[model samples]
Target chain A: MVLDLLASGLIYSSIIVLGSIGLSLVYSIANFANFAHGDTMTVGAYAALVTFGAVGGLGGTVLGLPYGFFVALGVGIGMAALVAVVTEKFIYEGMDVGSIGLLITSIGIAFIYRAIIQMGFGADFTRYDIPAMRPIDALVTYGIRVTLQDVAIVASATVLVVGLHLLLQYTDLGRKMRAMADNPDLARVSGIRTDRVKLWTWIIGAGLAGAGGVFLGLFSRLTPRMGFDLLLIIFAAVILGGIGSVYGAMLGGVLIGMTTQLTPILSELGAVLPLVPDTWGIPIGIEYANAIAFVIMVAVLLVRPSGIAGEVV
Target chain B: MSLRAIVDDPNAYWSGLTRAEQGVSGFIAGFVVLLLGGLFTGILAPTYFLFLVGIAGMYSLLSLGLNVQWGYTGLINFSVAAFFGIGAYGTALASASSSPVAGNLAPAVGLFVALVLAAILALLIGIPTLRLRADYLAIASIGLAEVVRIVILNEDQLTNGSAGVRGIPTFFDGWPLLDTFPQTMPSVAVSWLPSGTVVLGQSFWSALLNVVVVVSFIAVSYFVLKRAHRSPWGRVLRTIRSDEDLARALGKNTYRYKMQAFVLGSLIMALAGVFYAHLNLFVSPGDLSPITTFYVWVAVMLGGSGSNRGALFGGFVIVAIREGTRFLNAFEFIPFDVAPLRLLLIGVIIVLLMRFRPEGVLPPQRELIWPSVVDDAPEQPDSGVRDSKAGESND
Candidate 1:
């Protein structure tokens, strides 16, 4: 039972970590909470669907393995990046506004994107054309079942995080980006091109958001409102990890993912545990799972507003 | 001024008029719209359209509540719908039968309890969150609202769960006015009206009563808020909004002031919710979605945030747009669903407005004129006038 919980928790955390990285990066550099990041993830999933349709025969299995999934993933990431860049250039960059204005604009952008998705796709759940993979029972001796798709998600997430770390540490562009995030005016004074850094920020942040969306879609069915559903959870993760730290976002995502998955089991166990009465069980069903993120976020803010790794404002 | 001059340059037209002249013009314009809308819908359209107007009045009250928090105090509250839901469910449960799940109280008592509950809820939420930065407060409040909604959705016995509570007693069901006023009245129809003749019936009377109740709510709240806005208390709120640090430096106890504003605004929202519940004669979780909160935000932004009159006007405009689109939806030529399109247009409008005119249609009045010369002390820089001026330029 514990193994099953851990497997599901890991799957959920993989997607959350991907999404939170972008959110935290944007908050750090852009100096505003981008409410539309979740929708951008939805955009990525839809982009993958479009790509799969456009390249039908090419998506067929090769050597008894699905090779087309990789193509779709690349397309999803690129298309999501394009969407983010376009929005930045057209909407965000044109406005010389305050953080509040930016925040409001992000909300407007969220509405526009979600509405467009609804218009184009209708309010129906969709899925990728990729074939479903069977669970590899031989990999584990325990009763817990882990699917090949789950493995893919974990592997891809690990690779992405490592790649991100390498890029931030070893690359000049990454250093410039970090410098700007730390202090934009100082970085500019030190001859860093803040505009170019901002562009890269959107690209990298949105690329990861798109990847997260694709993974989430693989885990479940795709709906127009999927991004909105996951929005608060992503916010909780970003806020928990600290607003500006990528490493914090990763840790926060895993923690939130585990909490959301395990809380119900822990509450159910109250019935069997001798320490408490059977009636001491939590009355709230799993419907409260989404709300757990919010409760944690509020509690965290009250106790420590800067987040675990965030500097005091 | 000539009509052409007024039409050519509205800013100049507004500038040319005295404050009293502007006030009279605004009142006349509002009266004309109400009269025409009432007559047109009462005669031509079904009674349902008038119902929409009454709902608009409720929304206006919500916008006014939001204006006090977001506009006057610059506090971000994404949880208006939660307070609204509380007022609705509280009133419904209080006035309901004494079942195993709920209480049975009088409607008046229910309203009072809802108000108190909303105030207490606001105080609790504000105590923890108000000390944080604006965005943190925004995140926390939105989360708090979601938590409330989840609880309401799951606690079936108490709130009737997703099925919601029905058979809610209307405010006027046993009122003296219902007995005193005749249910039907003969009326002449205009030549342009679809119906050549008209007879106002029971539904019309009920609708009229609701309109009166809602309009009175708006008027009383408006006058009260306006008075508060012009008072020293209002000045302090504005100062807090413009520069919290300055207000704190002056020993204003900014936290306490903010908490008061939050509680007062939430109580007002709860009152609006009571009106909503009684008018609709039902309460449901579906009625208190985040979208409703966003709708109020749109109204507040469109009308002008800091201005009470602007909030009212914004509410009216949103209702007009919503009903107008629904009316348009009957036509067969439109290719796509009108609802999503309307929302998209609203989003675009908001983006454009934020980029171009964040101050809204009615910019907040920078100064209030008094006949007495001694009133000048309140308008000085010590009140954070310079900060507001800088904010305007930034916009």
Candidate 2:
């Protein structure tokens, strides 16, 4: 039972990390919380769905995975990036507004994005065309069920995280991005092209968000509100990791994922445990899963508004 | 002429006006609301539309509540729906007798309890959150709202779960007229009000009572908030909003002040919820979604965030748009679902307003000029005006 929870928690952590990194990045560079970030995930998922529909015949299994899946992933990433850039240019860039204005604008954009998705998707649950992968019984020997999809998700997420770390540490563009995030005016004074870095920030951040969306769709059903539903969790992760810290976001996501998953288990245990009262055994139930994120966020804000790994306010 | 002048320069126009001029403007605004209500009841002839207006009035109350926080105090409260739900469920649980979990109290007592509960909830939420940045408060409040909603949804024994609590007693249930009017009144007397009036017999008095309750609430809240806005406490709130550090440096217990504002606003929101529950004659988890919070935010923004009158106007505008779309949905010629489109339009409107006219229809008035001061000094160099302008430019 512990293993099962851990396995699911790890999957959830990866998806959350991908989603939150973008949020942190944007928050760092743009100096505003992009409430519409989660919707970008929804857009990515829908993009994948559309791509899969268009390339049904090209989806034959390769290495126990479909080729169409890769195409859909690519398309999803591309579309999310496109949408982010377009919104930044048209909606965000033109306004010389304060953080509050930007924040309100993001809320507006969030509404618009959800409405558009509903308009296109008809507010129904959708699934990708790929056949469901069979769980590998060999991996279940340890009392935890594992599937090929889970393996793929974990492996790809690791690869992506490592790649991101390398890019940030070793690359010139990454250095510029870091500089810009540290201080945009200083970065500009130092001859770094801030606008180019900003554009790249949107591309990469939005791309990762798109990838997270695809993973979310794999783990659960696609709905118009999938991203909206996940928004608070993403915010929790971002804030918990300390805003603008990529590595912190990863750690925050893992912590949040594990806590949310394990809380129900613990609640169940309370019911059966000899020392606990019978009435106390009643599990808090899964409906409170989202509430866990909120509680954590509030607790964190109260205790440490700067977040665990965040710089001093 | 006064309308055009007010429209052209909302702040300066109001500030420059005489006491009589300002009263005229106030009267005109009041007249407009009454006129709209008259149009809904007298001409539209649909009892349903009147209900919509009443609902709009409820939203106006919500906007006013929000204005106290987001507008006057500059606290970004995203838990409007949460407090609203609390009021509703609190009243539902208190007044209900059918539900096993209900307190089975009178509706009036329920309303008082709900208000207290909402105020307490706000105090609890505010104590920890109000000390943080505006964004943190926003996040926390949204979280709190969701938590409340989840609890309401899952606790079937307590809140009837997702099925919702029904058969909630109306506010006018105990009225003597309800007992005597329907049985004693002739059919011709009932029909005398109007053809399509839903307020017939007992319902007529009930509807009248509801209007009286709602309108009185609006009037009382308006006067109270206006008084608060002009008082020293309101000045402190404004100071806290503009710059908390400065307020703190000036020896104000900014935290306590913010908490007070938060609790007061939440209490007002709960009051609206109580009215909403009685009006709808039911309470459900679905009625208290985050979307309703956004609707109020939109209203607050559209009406002018810092202005009480603007909040009221914004509420009416939002309700008109929402209900207007519902009315439009009946038309067979229009293609596609109008519901989503209405939301889309609202979203667009918010974005556009933020971009172009963040100040809203009536830009918030800086200060109520005393007649003596106005005559003595036609143009007082008010620092508040300068600060407000700075705030406006940033948006």
Candidate 3:
């Protein structure tokens, strides 16, 4: 049972990691919390959904996902990037208000994005046109019931996250971006074109969020509110890992995801584990999973406001 | 800006107002006239109009609460709905006949309990987040709201679960004459040429009483807020908002002041929720949605962050948007769901309002000196720079 939960947690963590990296990136670079980031994920998911529906499965499958789905995923990433760039250029760039003002504006932008999506695709749950797959026969024998698609999600997320790591550590743009996020004014004084770096940050951040959204849709079903519903958890992960720290966000995502999936077994674990007596258990329902995550977030804020990987205040 | 000035030199007082202030007065005058015209012509049923007024008053109360937090102290509380819901559910559980936890208590008890609940919640959330950056509060508050909602949704025995607590009595339920006042009132009908005869019955009377209650709540809140906004305490809050470092350097406890503002704002929001529970006759987990929080946020921002009167104006505008979109379904030409349409309007308004006038339509004009001091001073300082000299300076 533990192994099965771990496998599912791995899948869930991939999606959260994708989302938190982007949010942390944006927070560090843009210098404002983008409330609209969740809706940006929604936009990516729907865009991919539309693309997948239009381009059939194209007659082949990889890891239980159609080739057309991968095409759709790429399109999703591109569209999310494009939309963020446009929003930055037209709406955010012209505004003179400080970060707080931008934060408020982002809430408005969030509403607009969600409203438009709801208008276009009626507020209903939808899924990509793919056949459902059962747990792999070999994995089920070991109580690790993960499907090929789950493997695919984890693999794709790994590729994207590692690619981001390389780009941030090795490339010139990455160095420039990191320097700009560290201190925009100092980077500007040092002759870096901050605007260009800021734009690239939005592209990469939003692009990763897009990938997360697509994977999330594949993991479950799609709805207008899916991204929004997941936003709080993603935020928890981002904060736990320490906002603006990419590595921290990844660690936070894994821990949060595992906790969420393992919630149902908490009472059982308490009773069975060595540290606890037989009758001592927290008999909480699975529905309180989100609540637990939020509680954990608040606790983290109280215990260590800077987050695990964040610089000490 | 003072009643004495208007009374002493009416013409000078009127002339002294800025064009924007004059425009606002004119707009308000026209709106009141329009509402009255609609009533006489039977375009609006008296009870429905009263209900609309009650809702507007509720929003105004909510906006006022948020103004105290965001306007005065620059704290971004995204848990407005949670506190509002606490006030609602706290009261509903105490008083609702269907409440599985407790039932049939006096509404006054509910009100007191609800406010206390809201205060506690404010502290619980504020203690952790208020000491952090503004954005952290925003994120944490949003999380707090979600947690409250989840608890409400899953705690079936305590809250009646998703089925909701029903059979909530009116606020005057246990009072003597006021308890049965609606049923005791006689029905009246007035004939109007345009729409037909309008009948005012027990429903109308009850709704009228709700309007009265909400209006009084609004009046008391407005008065208190106005006083606080012009006091030395309010000045410290405003100082914290503009420059926390400066305030801290001066030896003020910024965290304590922020906590007070957050708690005060949360209590007011709870009052609004208590009113809503009584007026709507039910309470549900749906009442705690994040959308409600954003709606209040828009109202506060659009009303001019720190301006109480602007918050009031923003309140009525919210009711218009909420109800106005429902009217679109009657037209048959608008081929869209009203929900998304309302959202679109709110989004567009927020974006446009921020883009054109981030300071809002009626930004706070007066300097934050104590009212008595301003009155007692021998010479008046130049108020023009603070009020009318520049548009972006205040922001």
Best by TM-score: 3
- Among all windows of 10 consecutive residues in model 2 chain B, the one with the lowest summed lDDT is B186-195
lDDT of 2 by residue, B52-106 (tens): 6678889999999999999989999999999999998888888876554756577
RMSD of each: 6.4, 6.4, 4.5
Instruction: After the best TM-score superposition of candidate 2, give how far the Cα of residue A235 lies from its true spot, in angstroms.
Output: 0.6
Model 2: residues with Cα > 4 Å off, grouped in runs: A57-59, A62-64, A269-283, B1-44, B176-205, B371-395
lDDT on C-alpha atoms for all candidate structures:
0.82, 0.82, 0.89
DockQ score of candidate 1?
A: 0.63
Report, in order, each candidate's fnat: 0.62, 0.61, 0.63
For residues B244-322, write the lDDT of model 3, one tens digit per residue. 9999999999999999999999999999999999999999999999999988888888879998988998898898889
List the candidates ranked by DockQ, beginning with the highest.
Answer: 3, 2, 1
Per residue, candidate 1 scores C-alpha lDDT tens digits across B208-299 of 77787788878888888888888888888989999999999999999988988898889888888988887888788987788778788888
How many angstroms is residue A154 displaced in model 3 relative to the true structure, after the best TM-score fit? 1.0
Per-residue lDDT value at A102 in model 2: 87
lDDT of 2 by residue, A1-313 (tens): 7788889899888999989999999999988988889999999999998997888647366535588887888899899999999999998998876888888888888889888888777877988766687778886888787788887777777878888899988999999988888888999999998988999999999999998999899888899789988989999998998988888888998888777876667666755577976556545787788888899999998898778788877
Deviating ranges (above 4 Å) for candidate 3: B1-14, B369-395
